[model samples]
Target: MSLNGPRGSAWAMTERTARDVDRAKHHFSVGPSAMRWDGETLVIDIAEVSSPLPYKVRGTIRVRPEMIGSTAFSLDPEGRHRWHPVAPRAHVEVSMTDPGLRWSGAGYFDSNFGDEALEDGFNDWHWSRAHLRNDVAVLYEGKRRDGTPFDLALRLDRMGNWHDIEQPAPVRLPRSAWMIERLTRADRGFIPRVAKTWVDAPFYARSKLSTRLFGENVEAVHESLSLNRFRSTIVQGMLPFRMPRAIWR
Candidate 1:
């Protein structure tokens, strides 16, 4: 399933496997999130998942070495249903040591999390108003040197009392940042000596939104989404929270 969607109104469990992180060691590795609405204040929950059991192949147990989680968001009545998922309510925690890495943040997701979740096909974009809506997210758009668009979605829910903030998300560094050095194009089979990555989610009017970046290993693409040009960037920003430095190496 894709990690992004636009909730006009809107909307996770796995077991012990090899691909799964060690429950005793790095079990808190989760995210690539999503967003939706619960009632008013927008409830978003992200999990640090770890299951090194391997899930894609048919070798009894196979899972990809990627992080997992989801985002929960509502819609902005002022924006007239311009669903958009932004920062979490607060900054989640991500850390990296010499042997372990963990990411503790919030987003939107249901079940089965891994790297395969960001592939070309085999994804489900969803939303919620009365019931869960299976949506077709417009992804694969950004300018990360190559063409690695980060597949994500968003939604603005009824602000209720705290209607001042459009997408109330708490931007946090990925746990990966704790262990890995400066991100380089080589991180994405491209360049080298990345310098560093910078982020700032400039939220303009509950509807207009965009993310900019400078460095390497990142990709951007602007694709089609219900007659809208949804642009995005893909970077290594999900480790500083749930992963330890040990696991990062």
Candidate 2:
């Protein structure tokens, strides 16, 4: 989930990336499927997969009744997860309801956060979320590439657990399928990508480092992630040779 507008409001833009596409159709996408109480706090499960990347990512975010203490999240698929107070509030900037999770507002660390800070945050941000429903309203507003205000919202759908498994295509793999693609939309447009998370991602480590580290030790935890550069790629505007991989899985 991503932050959209001011606090109490949110906007979410779910996308398909090159990683998910296949002969069936490039398809990597993310969405909230189910949310329920694991007692007092809310537990949300999320899955993601990228073709170019070897790992398929999936995990859950747990929220406590207090909305602060015991509120944590973990990504088991990528051999990564952070449970401590990553954000300043010692919790995430989230509020959930019936339809989906809205990343409308961030943490108190960002209460005073503006554009530059927000931009940096996005680049470095892993994820953020807010809960919402029909009774509850959420509005996400931001600047588009043209610098125009970009906004979206999740009013009321039917929050919690999607109708079925949040898979890209109907096809299945050993654990799950993973794919990636590079496309040109037009003469002058951004390339399209497809990735599937929650559906499948590979985990190579035998030891669950994050779970053990977070559940036990700490250096200095984080509440919300400060964006730096989420992802970067080098393309050939002009080049004689191309980089190639020697093997394929």
Highest TM-score: give the candidate number: 2
Query: What stretches of model 2 exceed 4 Å from their correct place?
Result: 1-39, 65-117, 120-218, 222-249
Cα lDDT tens digits, model 2, 1-249, are 322232332223234344533322322233433445444444555553322322333445554432222222221222133232222221333434412344422222212322232442232221122232211112222222223332222222222111211111111112223222111111122221222222121211011011111122211111122122212222221111221122221
Which 10 consecutive residues of model 1 have the lowest summed lDDT? 200-209
The residue-by-residue lDDT of candidate 1 on 124-189, one tens digit each, is: 121111101221111211122123222233322323111221221212222223222111111122
Q: Name the top lDDT candidate.
A: 2
